[model samples]
Target: MSAGQVIKCKAAVAWEPGKPLVIEDVEVAPPKVHEVRIKIVATGVCHTDWECLYGTGKGMKFRPFPLVLGHEAAGVVESVGPEVTKFSPGDKVIPLFLPQCGECDRCQSPKTNLCKKNWANTQVGVLADGTSRISCKGQQVYQFLGVSSFSQYTVVPDTSLAKIKSDAPLDKVCLLGCGVSTGYGAAIKTAKVEKDSSCAVFGLGAVGLAAVMGCQAAGAKTIIGVDINPNKFAKARVFGTTECINPRDHPNKTIQEVLVEKTCGGVDYALECVGSPVIMTAALESTTDAWGTCVIAGWSETEAMNVVVEKILMGRTLKGTYFGGWKSVQDVPKLVDDYMKNKLKLDEFITHKLKLDQVNEAFDLLKSGESIRTVISLF
Candidate 1:
């Protein structure tokens, strides 16, 4: 494989909104300047990818049809375009949807991880050159989040890639690209969870479970997992949850009220990973009044969050995190290194694995809450 060459490979394409992905042979063009082509080995099925396939109320803001949907992935560098010097063929890497362009204002800031240059292109679903490298049956296909790892081969900007150690397993590190990092970073980075403090995670999905792991790693004495599904509690405990609460169990009381009562006032930290504005509000209100911090790590399509004026006035801090507040170029590789050292848990998050042809069934597993993370094995 070389630059400017067209490679035919199998990919899951979204022909229309609210429809199952079609597995077809798509043409992946060679990388252009400052871009690299990757042979994706594995990709995790994330909620963001699912929401993009099924149109959100925001109306195609993210659900661009005829797009190759997927972002959280790990693969090998197949080829590099002109002017590319950092990576070469055979290098293992992960595609970062939230790229780290060091020259951008956000990248330079220590407080944020978002890159301005790549963030702008994220909305258009195209490469930095304002064009796509995927096509099928003579029709152009848009790249989702620039990576589009649902395809066997894809082109990505050099800045949007994180080279990892060769020994790292692609099937496992792929989860760190998004959900795990987002949830873990929300606890250790955004909220700065403290030792002996209490924390609450308001979802049992992969991201929420990662948050639980983060709190435990931070030495939090009491970790509470809240979800409507009780089946998830066992899995949550595997990640270090001290207690589990099903909101449905307390039908007469709000989740916030139950949380407040259980923690004696409220938890020192609350994380909303479900992406519902309702849950976001509850997480905030459930935090201890005079210093508790709440982090919103979920994505909501159309929900508008409403917070009481006094909530912030009383000293509660509310923050939003993207990609776990991690600098992809710098931090993702370190996360992989952490996993290699057994300091982070990745294998436990994967509840099911399927081939690319079973991609639709992966989504069904996620929707039914039967799996923590469904990995699509491209190889």
Candidate 2:
């Protein structure tokens, strides 16, 4: 690959959310130093993509309109940046939206999910070095979540690319890149769920299902799932949820009381997977009287909550997680291995596989509760 090589390909552009994913021809530039080009196999359409589409009350930091939308994905490395050391052409890789510069203090620390310095550019939806590698009709199109796997090909930082075994199906493993990792990490890593513990998850989307699976793997004896959609219960149970609640069924019931009754007390851990502030309140209030942990794992723009702070006065801790508090460099591959070993349920989470042209339909299914995950099969 040379400097001026322009690889023309198809991409799903998000001119607006409710509008369809505009399909157009785009130019993917050759990889720069420390970057790699991937022929995307599949990309998972997640709620984060939806949020990025319709600016969730919290204004998007990434600039407006005429942008490619998507993040969660897996693919094969087609080329490498000049200085890239860890990967080569033909390697199977999963793109991490939050790239990590291994030498950064935050990456060195066990607590944070991101490498502060490496992400300065990705936050703006450009390449890490300050410019974009993808453009359309000569205009620099915004790269949503850095990877922009909505395209037939995507260029990502080497640090953002994790090499996985080629044997694993790209479609299933791609979900692990984002929602699965976020939800699983929220329960297994951030919350540090204990065996036989009582846990309640406040959403039943893909991430919520991943959390439920993580809670089960961590040996949680009681797993309660809360969701607005009653249809998610069957799927949640397959992911290890022991009980399910539809908010509609408890119209007059308080979230706290309902959870208390379900768990025989408050839950040992409560996970808020929905971005709503009201749900966050419910998560906090649903925890056990003391030594309970409430984890806010939802990607939301809501800031204020109707909270009674006293509910958490009894040694209950409110925690927030980013990518499940996972260190991508370490955890991503482990997740893949777990999936391959059948230790984690990956297949159950996927509800649809779509082509780039059908990307917007994927979002519609997500919003209408018609699908748990919609994967864009670029291959």
Candidate 3:
């Protein structure tokens, strides 16, 4: 617990692709310059983590193995290195997988939330220093998404830390780190959904549900939830989905056809929460002609997202977002505050909670489409 001192702790390490994680003792090197060490209290299992583990996508197949893989996490700062002025010991914070270097052009521009400088290091699973902070039995373990909350303890750049209120429940607010924020922001920020407008959301996972909640918050009159699984409809309703449609029920008709017919042409806004190229195309096609806006919130690692050029030519806008278009360090704290005030629904998103030992089981729940968000308690 002092600066520059290594600490040994438990971490769920992914040894290889398509393999269960192993809870092993990991040596976490103390904060280097401008870095802060955190004791992870809770983390959420995200689909992106699962994709990183088993996805055969271009960059995903080549990801460095023996990596620690949880990103949506909330923790208390245990130590801070030299030149770290933003946070101190005992401060509650969420580690941002997307760090915000305010000096970057992307950070300075109002049009984007992506910080251009720190993002390159995330591709290689190294820190800003171009090295790993975790080691197991003298072998290096790469960090995942820069946050790497799978470990009981993690070290991140000071710029990556989003300090929140001390009393905020780490277990619930941890969802704000990714899913909740990404989904909710896709509606409120990216799409800027208008009041009483019709909206269609594809997929019913945590991110999709959050998108539903966001559309409701924006006062959308007709919020339609589209998913292949009927079981997800009940929970999707609780999150403000006014109508539910299962593609399985309409086998004769395409999902986009059903949605467009149901909405009397097409919806005002269409949000694609599923990372499928087919669904991405359908989402675009399901929107109202001339004015419909389609926001791609899901992260699709595969190469081409083919859509008819005529779709855009007809005045339908296709846009993509990262982290829901919210600047992480600047906006995540406010989201935590919104959750505390009951303006945001965090508890409803958490369908299961498990201990660190059940990390693989959490992934199973996600893969089986049985849980909305499974929070892993590291404490």
Clashes of 1: 0
User: Model 1, range 1-379, lDDT digits (tens) per residue?
Assistant: 3556899999999998888999999999999999999999999999888888774565235446689998999999999999999999999999999888789778889989888665666566788888888999999898998889899999999999999999999999999889999999999999899999999999999999999999999999999999999999999999999999999999999999999999999999999998888899999999999999999999875668989989999999999998889998999999999999999999999999999999999999999999899999997
For candidate 3, lDDT tens digit of each residue in 276-378?
A: 8888999999998999999999877655677999989989999988899999899999999999999999999999999999999999999999999999999
- Model 1 CA deviation exceeding 4 Å by range: 1-3, 58-62
Native-to-model Cα distance after best TM-score fit, residue 248 in candidate 1, in Å: 0.4
Q: How big is the RMSD of model 3?
A: 1.1
TM-scores across all candidates? 0.98, 0.96, 0.98
Ranking by lDDT, best first? 1, 3, 2
Look at candidate 1 and tell me the lDDT of residue 169.
95
Q: lDDT per residue, candidate 2, 292-352, as tens digits?
A: 8999988764467776767767789998898888888677888899899989888898899
Cα lDDT for residue 371, candidate 3? 94
- What Cα-based lDDT does every candidate model obtain? 0.92, 0.85, 0.92
Q: How many backbone clashes does candidate 3 have?
A: 0
- For candidate 2, the TM-score is 0.96
Name model 2 segments beyond 4 Å from true: 1-4, 16-18, 56-62
